[model samples]
Target: MSRVGKKPIALPGGVKLQIGEELQVEGPKGKLLVPIPKGITIENKNGTVEVTRESDKYAALHGLTRALASNAIVGVSSGWTRELDIVGIGYRCDVKGNLATFTLGYSHSIEFLLPQGVDMTVDKQTHIVLKSHDRQLVGQVAAKMRALRPPDPYKNKGVRYTGEVLRKKVGKSGAGGKGK
Candidate 1:
C-alpha cells in the first residue's frame, strides 16, 4: 500500500469535489481537474477524500494520483504563489496589465505576456510575485522568467527565486599569477 495514497485529504471550507472519469475540485479561489488513472479509485467520506489502488501493479500511480488530487483541492481553496528576484545593476521588471517587461541586462528589453491563469506583480521593479490557482502554471511561469537570464555563477546576476542560495564562483582575477 502506498502511504501517500492511503492518507485522507481534508476538504477545507468552500471546496467541493466531483468524482467521475476525473476529479473536479472547485473552491473559492478557482477550479481544477485531476485525471483519474486506471486501477485507481477515489472516494469522499464526510469531508475527507481518499485514494486507493486496485493492486500493487498501480503502486507508482497511486501516490501520484493522490498528490495531484490533493494539490488540486488545496489550489482551488487557497491558491499558490511563486516569488522571484532580479539581481543586477540594471536588471528590473515591470508589469502593466497582462504584459510584463523585463530589463535583464540584454541589449533590448524582453516583453513577456502573462498567461490567462497567472497574475504577476512587481515590487520596487526588482521583486516579482506570481500568483495563480494552478500550482503547475505558477511554477512554469516562474521557471520561464528565470530562464530569461539565469543567475551568473561569477557575478551572481540575473533572475532567481526568493531565498535561493548560490555559491559565487571565483573570477579570473582571483586565479593565481599564471598569466603574469
Candidate 2:
C-alpha cells in the first residue's frame, strides 16, 4: 500500500473540488486541474479528498497522483508562493504590470514578461515574491528567472532561492613568480 496515496487531503475554506476524468479545484485565488491516470480514483467527501488505486501495480503512480491532486487542491485554496533573491552589487528588480526588469551587473537590463496566472511582488529591490495557483507553473517561472543569473560557485553571487544554502569556493591568491 502506498502511504501517501492512503492519506486524505483536507480542503480549506473557499475551495471547491470536482472529480471526473480529472480533478478540478476552484477557490478565491484561482482554479487548478489535475489529470487522473489509469487505475486511480478520487473521492471528495466530508471536506476531505481521497485517492485510491486498483492494485499495487500502480504503487508509484498512485502516490504521485495523490500528491499532485493534493497540491492542486491546496494551490486553489491557500495558493503557492515562491521567493527569489538577487545577489550582487547594484542588482535590482522592478516589476510593473506583467513585466519585470532586472539589472544584474550586466551591460543591458533584462526584462521578463510574466505569463498569465502568475503574479509577482518585488521587495527591497532585490527580493522577489511570486504567487500562482498552479504549482508547476509557478516553479517553472521561478526557474527561468533564476537561470537568468544563476548563482556562481566561486562568488556565490546571483539569483537564488529564499534560504537556499550554497557551497562557496575560495579564489586563488595572486602570486607573480617566474620559474627558471
Candidate 3:
C-alpha cells in the first residue's frame, strides 16, 4: 500500500484537471501535460484525484504517478520557482525578455534561450529566479542554467542554487616536492 498514492490530490479552484490517456492540467499559470503510464488508473473524485494500479508490478509507479500528478496540479494552480545564485568575481546574470545572459567569470557571456511559459528574473546580477508552471520544465531549465557553471569544489566558485551548501576544499600547505 502506497501512502502517497492512497492520498487524494485536492484540486484547488481555477485549476482544471482531465484524467485520460494523459493528465491535462490547466490553470492561471499555464497548461501542463503529464503522461499517464500504462497500468495506472486515475479516478477523479469530488475536488480530488486518486490513482490506482492495474497490476502489482506497477505498484511503485502508482505512488510516483500520483505524486507527479499532484505536483502538476499544484504547479498549474500556483506555479513553480527555482532560484540560483552566482558566486565569485564577475559572476552575474541578466535576463532579457525570454533569454538569460550569464557571466560566470568567463571571458564571454553566455546566453540561454528560455522556453515559452517560463519567466526568469535576475536580482543584483547574482541572484536569479526562475518561474514556470510546468514542474519538469522549471527543473530542467534550472539544471541547465546551473550546469553552465557548476560550483567548483576547490574554490567553490560558480553558479549554485540559493541556499545550496558547498563543501570547500582546503589547499595544501607550501611544501616543495621533487623528492626534497
Q: Estimate every model's Cα lDDT from 0 to 1.
A: 0.94, 0.92, 0.89
Writing each residue's lDDT as its tens digit, candidate 3 over 5-104 gives 8898999999887877899999988788888999999988888888998778998999999989999999989989999899998888888899788888
TM-score of each: 0.96, 0.95, 0.94
- Show where candidate 1 strays beyond 4 Å: 174-180
- lDDT, candidate 1, 1-180, per-residue tens: 889889999999999889999999999988899999999999999999999989999999999999999989989988999999999998999999999999988899999999998989999999999999999999999999999999999999999999999999977766567594
| Candidate 2 worst ten-residue window by lDDT | 171-180
Model 2 CA deviation exceeding 4 Å by range: 174-178
Q: Give the lowest summed-lDDT range of ten residues in model 1.
A: 171-180
- Candidate RMSDs in order: 1.5, 1.3, 1.4
**Model 2 lDDT at residue 5:** 91
**Native-referenced Cα lDDT, model 1:** 0.94
lDDT of 2 at 56: 89
On the 0 to 100 scale, the lDDT of residue 136 in model 2 is: 95
Better structure of 2 and 3 per lDDT: 2
Candidate 2 global Cα RMSD: 1.3
